[model samples]
Target chain A: MRPAKTMKIELKVNGKRERREVPPSRTLLELVREDLGLTGTKAYCHSGICGACTVLLDGAAVSSCSLLAAQADGAEVTTIEGLAADGALHPIQQAFIDHFGFQCGYCTPGMVLLTKALLDEVPEPTREDIVRYMGGNICRCTGYAGILASVEAAAKALSTKD
Target chain B: MRPFEYVRPTTVGEATDFLREHGDDALVVAGGTAAVVMMTLGVLRPDYVVDVGFIPELGPELDGSRSGGAGLRLGALTTVRSIERDPAIAGAYGLLADAASQVANVRVRNRATVGGSVCYGEPQTDLPPALIAMGASATIAASTGVRTVPLAGFFEGPYETVLQAGELLTEITVPLPEPGTFGCHAKFTVGSPENKPVANASVLVRTDEAGRCVEARIVMGAVGPVPVVAEAAAALLAGEVPDAKLIAEVAARAADATDPQDDLRGPVWYKRRIAAVLVERALSCALRKAGNGTR
Candidate 1:
């Protein structure tokens, strides 16, 4: 097989504008992990599921594995590392800590980012809305109840703040 | 992932030139949902990958009306999530949205292109069968030029499409159903939150001025090598009311229409049975929606 060709993209990653020359076949998951050195995004299945690699592409949560690094061109990407205030944690991150949302914490980044996206979209989403929107993120830790509670808690916090 | 030469063509013509120069050794990466993941898994390794994701021509173009029989014109690069949120699509072609929204997850939907799904034509894909029900068409372009192929005619066989070596799927045109029409999509995937549907079905129904059944179509996906039309189910609605018994019979015909095989998802028989049940349930839901409208 031949070596994959590379393409360059101008991405605003973690609030810093950087240029990345990525393989045409390189996934967004790889871009965030390898080139940018932002390993907070983890992909368990490396497919669409397992939510281990979920990140906000253009402010919408999506599976990074399914996207080519070249596709992130001219877009804003916010990974787990980008979700804080100065050095402080984002509220969603705090909700996870407060609700004890992690067991092994392997899926925490993906779940936290995915939840952050949902709460961003619907600050007062109902339980069913939460389930449908958050169904893609899988937690093998069997810590779903805690994750759901954390999202709900974050939602409550956001509503009160609003 | 095996190393391969990646080429980013600035325009569709440049992309086509790359394909024409590379042939089977080349592959077009639209949304990169299937190709990117497969390449990463070593399931596929093509030489000279062409990046078409940035081609402005292939994006979601929503005109306020999915009515007037002129539905939304979806570029091949239109992400599944685009369908999920577009009110025109959700309001007019909601079934497509239902299928599109549920594809993989929001993450994959953000990058998975509509044309990519139809062009890939994987038997396990979720779009073809739904398009079959909606009377959608695929606009395929090649060196000789483009032609509009009805969604049913595009799927040649397993993992193949009528798309030529140099041809790229440019658009997916979802023809709006008539006013006072109802449509629904169902799939038997093992991962849905409500119930893991192993079989997927799309049903569309239109009633006449006198409140008689005028037209209907139910398409089944993931059951066979290609999206098969549920002719028996469609025929049953010629002049009959979409009652429970009739809907059940139509759904049964839809199930029997397919010769599904065993795979990781489920057994062949199981898929067939769900196809029917989902078809019935979907049509019933469509009927209810139709009743609620100002028909």
Candidate 2:
């Protein structure tokens, strides 16, 4: 039998520093959900076609399922669990509830994280911008109308709060 | 997925040396977007995954030292998202930027590297056709020495590149189009915008002050095993005033150059027809973009 190889990686997950010894094949999704117990990041299409495993890697939205934990070493990772502050729902998360952003809620984490990334980049995005930027995060339910409204509401809410 | 040992080298030289020692057993990954997916699907089972993402020299940089000559140097690790958003690149190579923005989606673009995209040798991609049309060249690093290859001749076949074992694609240099030169990329997707293109065309046309075609380069993607250059189509446009009739003929010739395969995107015949229409659209768009500054 061949001996399995493991590599030690250190990364900042959700503003908390984390260190782990993971195998080369261990994906960032696996590390976050299994090892770190952060299951908020879902894994859907591991081939990167679907955005169910989206997360913020150094503030940019990326598919965590297609990324290796070892590859993210020394980088900062922001999962869905990182969004809120001190027992409060993030404005983006609340906006989803206010606007029915999801139905089954399977793709909410990715959609919310991607929304965070889009809003951070484009503070005041037009409807067209919202549609284009959020095209990657697919939701089989809610038909995306609610998601679009949620994103628009989130943008407005975030701006007003600021 | 098969288990493998991961090795991260902080320098290109160190990465090449490790690759040389391991030979085919080592697979070099830049962004790990494609590699990780392949690894998970059991399509790639390398014994050693040599990650070059840690190599600072290969990281993102937009060196315009050749700005005097209107050339640009892009490091291997330049993400597709950066190419789409970088003002400098967007200003000089808008066609490349537009094509980069069309790749997969925001999440994939955030992680996929330009070098990784080219090295992956996927025919149904966007960047290669535009890069080929822009007359790009790849700088490859090896333990033996360094070499440069024109981007047009880089691909050997589907999922294959001319890069030998232990070699690394370190940089891509694009010679900016001359004045009065305009380019456009037209892609036909099956349904969704993020889906792989069924047939795509990139046309770069340079016209003289009198509106006579001085040079033209037409490249087709997703309709061939590799990015296919429509030499005959380009030759037809050379020294001619591009009228609708001439453009139509050129587009037909461009379609003739394609060798598409039946895939989930579309069948071969449909791809050929779509390729022709896309070529026509791209050529017309490029001609219209000349001195107009509207794409």
Q: Write the per-residue lDDT of candidate 1 for residues A7-108, one digit (tens) a residue.
A: 767888878998978767677888889888899988677667677888888788877887877778888889999988889888899999999888989889
The CA lDDT at B104 in model 2 is: 88
Tell me the tens digit of each residue's lDDT in model 1 across B30-55.
77768877888898888767778767
- For the predicted complex of model 2, DockQ is 0.57
Candidate 1 regions with alpha-carbon error over 4 angstroms: A1-4, B60-69, B191-197
Model 1 DockQ class = medium
Cα lDDT of model 2 by residue, A42-99, tens digit: 9888988779999999999999888889889999999999999998999999999999
Candidate that would win on DockQ: 2
Model 2, range B1-295, lDDT digits (tens) per residue? Answer: 7888778888888888887888599778888888999989999889988888888898665544533365878889999988888877776688888788888889999889999999999998899999999999999999999999999999989999999998999999899777777888899887677788898888888888778899999999998889999998899988888899998999998899999999898888899999999999999998888747554
- Cα error of candidate 1 at position A80, Å: 0.8
